[model samples]
Target: MKPLERLGEAKTPDGTVLQLYRHDGAYLIRADGVELMSTRRHLSEDKLAEVACAPLVTKPKARVLIGGLGLGFTLREALRHLGPDAEVVVAELVAEVIQWNANPEYALSAEAMADPRVRIVHEDVSKVLRNNVGGFHAIMLDTDNGPEGMIMKENSRLYATRGIAATMAALKPEGTIAYWSVGDDPGFVRALENAGLEVKAMKVRAHATSGPFHTLYIAS
Candidate 1:
């Protein structure tokens, strides 16, 4: 068996360690010691984009905002679903993760990041949502273990009441927002409803054939 090799490491604002590793051709990103994302299972990430962007497939020049660049699968999948004229703005707080994905030697998301439709913003996703009022046709959140902050303590603000309001305000009248989670959270669903959104929660597999179930929350 090939050994797991640590490729890169960085420190979060709270000083927790973020590390990237490769084993048997698969890449994984972990916060502290918890796995955040992995190239081995990304079906749920793909579904997050598919479900969020489906309504905008035929809408010309649609704009989408994605929180977190994790492995770039969500961005790549969003690009695949949307038309050429559409735009995708990715807000990634960790600059090192962007560098890792853009590193061709890592064979992660370099190609996806280069897609003409993608605009990378090296900033907090909350700030991006706050600044872009009524800007995006779709917003996808696959950040920090979903609705809770596993990597950064500040990330929980994205799912807070004020954050949900800001997120809803940043969307067009009919725009949709999708969230990816490791498990179901009824409280999060209620928060979306309190923000006046109709929420739909779907259980998705981590991989196409078989893997642990994950949750995809779609709100509009």
Candidate 2:
């Protein structure tokens, strides 16, 4: 068994304590002693920023918004697929989690922070989506374990009907919104449908280098 090491800490808007840890070369975030993400060599544990882009972000001027910054895995993987003209904006609620990437001691796994095309915003993703930045090419959300939402009480709203609508409004007509889940979620898909999005879920296996086995909700 791989040992657990404390990496950092994060607190939600409502003041829930989240502890970051590492195991077997993977990173995990926990809240009230519950394991949030047990990272592997793959990005599915932090999907949206990495795996979700496989189908949608092909253009040279793709503007992407990544929700969550877990270990920087998804952000780094995202950079690999984007062109020089691409721009990635990450929305992270916790400032410390962002620091983990910039902090010299933590060894930023994704290094997305250092990238010239990346922008980190310290705020709730839900509020930013309300900003309706307009004309975003893709929006990938890996904010919680899944639609079930345990890390933060308000996180479930992201999967709610209104939230889905807001996300759709924030995107261009041809834009894609990809959601990451720890497991399968059907209700969230229904919300996407209610928002008038053409939705497709791609099931991806949780692992390293295994391709497209995880379910990605591609709503356009």
Off by over 4 Å in 1: none
Cα TM-score per model: 0.97, 0.87
What tens-digit string does per-residue lDDT give for candidate 1 at 67-141?
999899999999989999999999998889999999999879899888899999999999999899999999999
Clashes of 2: 11
Q: Largest TM-score belongs to which candidate?
A: 1
Q: For residue 18, give model 1's deviation from the true position in Å.
A: 0.8
* Candidate 2 lDDT, 71-138, residue by residue in tens: 67778878887888888888888888887777766656545587898989998888888885675778
Candidate 1: what lDDT?
A: 0.91
